[model samples]
Target: MPNLDLWTFALNCYAREGVETACLELQSQGADVCVLICAAWLEARGVARNQERMCVLEEVAAPWRHIVVEPLRELRQAWRSPAEQDEALRELRKTLKTLELQAERSLLERLQTASREWDESADANQWLSALAPKGSCRVALETLRNAAYQTQLELAGV
Candidate 1:
């Protein structure tokens, strides 16, 4: 588990039952899915949560998400209905989806690099709670947290 990367961990956690819905719910409420995934990764790795690290991660992610991911997502969402009728538009939308995913992956890599040197601590990891948006759905956040813990156990073969 020492070498577990954030992207793989995020994918696995997201693939778990209820996790996608949970993440989507959180996302719709203004939480950054990538940052939430990074939080889950850090929690699973036993990295203690603190305001300083949280700020650093947010600083690293906010601009990229606003400038790159958000525009692609907005464009794709705007095309959703039109793409249903136009084949070419559908194809273009598909490409946009792929690009959006790539952008998220790139963001995850940057988050990993930013937090790579942080040492794990015995202090309880509250990353998921700390990173989740205020007034967010508790059920969705718990779903994400449970999936992440289950993913960690699965990866550790426990």
Candidate 2:
């Protein structure tokens, strides 16, 4: 559970080039960005993915994701054009986007706390596939996994 703060993992990963775009693409396909961040952390820490852990994640994150995080994300995305047109709206939109990211970080914290009992074993694809499913968000999952791997490698200085 050491170094498993979901927020830290996510911020580090999301800061990587192309990760934000990839995450947004996955979100468009109904993939839970919180779950994706959890998956990346699990993968990075060598956590095993299974039904029990999945259920834990879902229970912890589903409500917040559906009710809070997703709405903030949608609102942030919805502001993209309006923010561009109005100079004043730009700063407000930026603050909102920051809030959206913080909301996601809270969701990730919940996930990390709930998943503390699970075993750790690495395999990036399982969590992505489990969260997304075949043919639904496959491309996004693949894209995320590749990006996660590169980010992990880079962070490790390998």
Candidate 3:
């Protein structure tokens, strides 16, 4: 019943050795971690790359990330320095950071459900072979793709 859907794929992929740190680094550089997760998931499912599909994914994720997740992340990061002197605030910020991650997971779930229709591509083997990672995280993104694809293939045999 629980095959490697987008959310599961994301959790497993993000848990891979370099994936979480790489994703965080990419996020800091303005990449949407949710979108990155979608990219990996779609790749795993053999969904063809569609610019319109990509745009839809971005549109769905950006507002929640901006309005909910980023603020929490900003507050958490800003509190890191202050946490050095205040143990209570440090604990609170830690809780807030965990909440932020939960929000991101919710967003990831939304992305997953939204893109399930993409199982059948409108086209096959288009010019676009990969999702572009913004900023300097290309290496990290490549790592994610390789790991995700490998994981998908591995699990497919199971």
- Expressed as tens digits, the lDDT of each residue in 1-158 for candidate 1 is 56488888988999999999999999999999999999988898788888999999999999999999999999999999999999999999999999999999999999999999888889957798889999999999889988988898887677
Ranking by lDDT: 1, 2, 3
What are the per-residue Cα lDDT tens digits for candidate 2 across 1-158? 34546676677788877778888887777778888878877776667787877888888888998898878778878889998999888898889888887887788888888877667555523677777644565656767777666666665666
Clashing pairs in 1: none
Write out the backbone clash pairs for model 2.
46-120, 46-121, 46-122, 47-120, 47-121, 48-121
Error of 1 at 14 (Å): 0.7
**How many collisions between residues are there in candidate 1?**
0
User: Local distance difference test, per candidate?
Assistant: 0.92, 0.75, 0.75
Better of 1 and 3 by TM-score: 1
After superposing candidate 1, which stretches have Cα over 4 Å from the reference?
A: none
Q: Which numbered prediction scores highest in lDDT against the true structure? A: 1
Judged by whole-model lDDT over C-alpha atoms, candidate 2 comes out at 0.75
**Candidate 3, residue 64: CA error in Å?**
0.5
Q: Which sections of candidate 3 miss by over 4 Å?
A: 1-3, 120-135
